[model samples]
Target: MNQIVTFGEVIMRLSPERNKKFIQSNRLEFYFGGTEVNVGISIANFGGEVKHISCISDDFVGDTAISYLRKFGVDTSSTVRSKLPLGIYFLEVGAVMRPNSISYNRSHSSFSEIKPEMVDWNASLKNCKWFHWTGITPALCEGGYHTLKEGLVLAKKKGIEVSADPTYRSGLWKYGADPKETLSDLLNYSTIFIGGVNEMNEVLGSDYGDSNEDFIEAGKLLLKKFPSIKKIFDKIRTPINASWHKIRSRMWNGDEFRETTDFDITHIVDRIGTGDAYAAGLIYGLLNFDDFKAMEFGAAASALKHTYEGDVNFSSVNEVMNILEGNTSGRFNR
Candidate 1:
């Protein structure tokens, strides 16, 4: 079977010790992560054959980053190495009422300097069954955007399914074009889209109502606008505090709405990469299960992610199924 391919930047994550604020902490833990990389890790954990494409500095940090991915079962044979330094981000894990904070030190990093000319679209995507990327990629540089677009076109030509998450971080798109236009341009090639209802209204001039009914209406309009889009998925979060939250996922498959069981998360280990976990689960489910099952599988995976601290969701498929099968009792295994 061909592998599922992902393209993006992988940064070195620096976080204070668990539950410690940055200003008060004297120690930091290092981990390599990025949106696409996180998703690739989850998919790989589930025994999916996955490959990631990106550039890192030709240094010890870059070598460690690639090895970190290899440890998680992701193929990094296509990774590029340049003279630039690796991107870095500082994360401060928060407690009740205090939110998590991220400070990026990633400007002009090796990954940001990568151009379309640096990658071979056909060779990278060859024999790939699915191609994945996010809004974060194009935000890096003009060459990044062109490279992503080229990859999308090449994937389509290769008959590969395309999945995308419109992460929609406004600050990332400061390279001179409106995020709306840029996102729409890339998303036009997507078969499965993961984004929010309000994002639709804010990004495009679409007036999908603000309420539940509005979301359904907006979903319909989105399908109409992008005929190739087969499934639209998003989740709703009911935060009880910084540590606990109620979450569930919903999807519009052009035919009907598919909803998942409501999930209550009483503890959150690290919320940073939970969205990517959800996306990975959804993508994995879509490849293996029906739409109804896929929705719940994704939500269950996210619920399990809340119990672990890291950029990757270490939860196994059995664990996710255990949660989804109504086995919420966190019992010990004999």
Candidate 2:
């Protein structure tokens, strides 16, 4: 019963080789990743048993995607197949001051057709100790919301620890469901909140400033409103530019506040899925370490993700520990 369960869409990502724009590159590289899948894969890479449940197209593309997950040691037994095509998004990786741009083509994809009846929550969460989800799934469509709600309800009944990352994306909530209401309902079943002040304010509809004091007040208020939430964690990033950024994390465990020092990443290979990396690290850390150390591990994992290309964070636990030990010299390994 120590397995971790992740539920979300599995998307195909296409990007031009190098930092070139779409107009400059004739060849494009592809990777299979989704927010929850990235987290599951990263946790598996860290030697944690993880299972990802999603609906993928019944085609060669879907076959490759499932293979990719298995290649990272993630269990895909819960994955369902659909006749529709798989969802895809294109990325134009940026450098320096230029920012990365993404265009999504997932509106009518296979994952969008997911229904509550399509998944057996009881079976999917079997032997599960932790469950992870994000706002992205619910934002996709009405069925996505209902299906996730079903899983959350069952996961709560099983007494599994649930982590909610309410990534409010206004653009994706085209299904007419109120974002705040949807997220607030899901939070009732979640034990951990893996997002920051902006995310808190979005769900709470409160206007809190960006200071430590404000964060504390906001966290306290959030826990009060949603009594199920035992801890709140946030990854703060200060971007000097698209390629250079500083990252740190903080947490409020309904008792005390803890923060970590800034980690400077002067060169970023790819920024996609870094937040998922943070969430993955936090999930793995909480299962093994104390609250504060978990937050530190999450921040370190996020910093390391910036140095990798593609959508997944491939850093091992030892590699993340090296970052936590302040060993960012990038020296040769014996």
By TM-score, the best candidate is 2
Model 1 ranges off by over 4 Å: 207-210
TM-score of 1: 0.97
Model 1, residue 150: distance off in Å is: 0.4
Quote each prediction's TM-score. 0.97, 0.99
Angstrom error at residue 144, model 2: 0.9
Candidates' lDDT values, in order?
0.85, 0.94
Q: What ranges in model 2 sit over 4 Å off?
A: none
Model 2, range 60-178, lDDT digits (tens) per residue? 99999999999988999988999999999999999998999999999999999999999988898888999999999999999999999999999999999999999988999997999
RMSD of each candidate relative to the true structure? 1.3, 0.7
Model 1, 20-67: lDDT tens digits are 987888899988899999999999998899999998899999989999
Worst 10 residues of 2 by lDDT: 249-258
